[model samples]
Target chain A: SQELEQSPQSLIVQEGKNLTINCTSSKTLYGLYWYKQKYGEGLIFLMMLQKGGEEKSHEKITAKLDEKKQQSSLHITASQPSHAGIYLCGADWTGATNKLIFGTGTLLAVQP
Target chain B: GAGVSQSPSNKVTEKGKDVELRCDPISGHTALYWYRQSLGQGLEFLIYFQGNSAPDKSGLPSDRFSAERTGGSVSTLTIQRTQQEDSAVYLCASRPDSNEKLFFGSGTQLSVL
Candidate 1:
């Protein structure tokens, strides 16, 4: 049903430039997670936000969940070549399934 | 301290045949999941197994798609009478618990001709 939507299907930036990716959901998000996958590989977990208005950071990546509880943003500061990959956002809705519904993804190209 | 692992990094098969993919989750991890990723597409949830309980098969695309996890460790996904539409990278993931972050495997690339 495409509950989650992401913007800027693809993005390119200089190696040192900063970038932001957005994710919005039609339904309230019970849990929000961000993951990155390189070419032909598995996704690596980046961060997760459960409560609205919560923010978390890892290294140069900072993620925030809006207080409205239907949106999230991933910010990468001082991006590097290694940051090139597909970034996916997944949401866990209310249910016993707890299954993750993923967005199409955002392809990030960090040009050196 | 190894992460999840999948066997047969790549598989090429013809239609009407059967294929089996294996996944070995991290030791002691109780939650396991199977997902499929079409080329340049988002991950598609297939099935999930938590410990020794009954698996949640609601996401399976069809009756031909079935999976089993034995002894709460190794798991296998089987597809019978495969079609070209079944071609995709099958990914496996595991987490210590339902609330923890998932650890994924490299995945098995299946090409059904």
Candidate 2:
């Protein structure tokens, strides 16, 4: 079985500051996904990374997967109050099954 | 129709009662999944349905939990003799066969009293 561990379980940052959240897996990652969830709401898809050393950005948010494929990071530039929520990283372990294993999640609080 | 939809946005049930949660995936999606999210915790995979058959159900926590999909469109998750530990938000997701991205529903918040 594989597990994902996220660093900085909870973080509080100023609205204009920058921050980074990391997700590490015990095994090599085949497919990695990032999602955001508001309180008591469903998750919204953010980005997905497949190949190792891959990087993708949406607006001010950027995500990178390491060459080893065992670690990934999400970076937010000029954070906003709207970025305050739980960010989760999900991994596709088997590739065939749509079942994704998720990390405990990082709670981000961007103070205005 | 546009995205995954779950029924009974909130459910409050007493112990020893049975409850069923429904999920309606996006039209034409062949892959559907069910996950549980406890308070302050990550999502836990419960089951996956490919079309009308379930190829993986190993994530189910107990025998008391069961789910079924019919006609490759709708899914229902049933919990028998619900326990307090069963309280959580059940989320449903669906994706097309061509991609790995999953579209999620608002989820059903279940409170077992």
Error of 1 at A85 (Å): 0.6
TM for every model, in the order presented, reads: 0.92, 0.95
- Residue A39, model 2, lDDT: 93
lDDT of 2 by residue, B1-111 (tens): 878999999999999999999999999999888999999988898998887564589889999999999888899999999999999999999888624888999999999
- For residue A98, model 1's alpha carbon misses the true position, in angstroms, by 1.4
Q: State model 1's lDDT.
A: 0.91
Top candidate on TM-score is: 2
For model 1, the stretches where C-alpha displacement exceeds 4 angstroms are none
Residue-level lDDT for B59 in candidate 2: 89
Candidate 1 local lDDT, B1-113, one digit each (tens)? 49899999999999999999999999999999999999988888899999888898988999999999999999999999999999999999988877667889999999998
Residue-level error in angstroms, candidate 2, position A11? 0.8
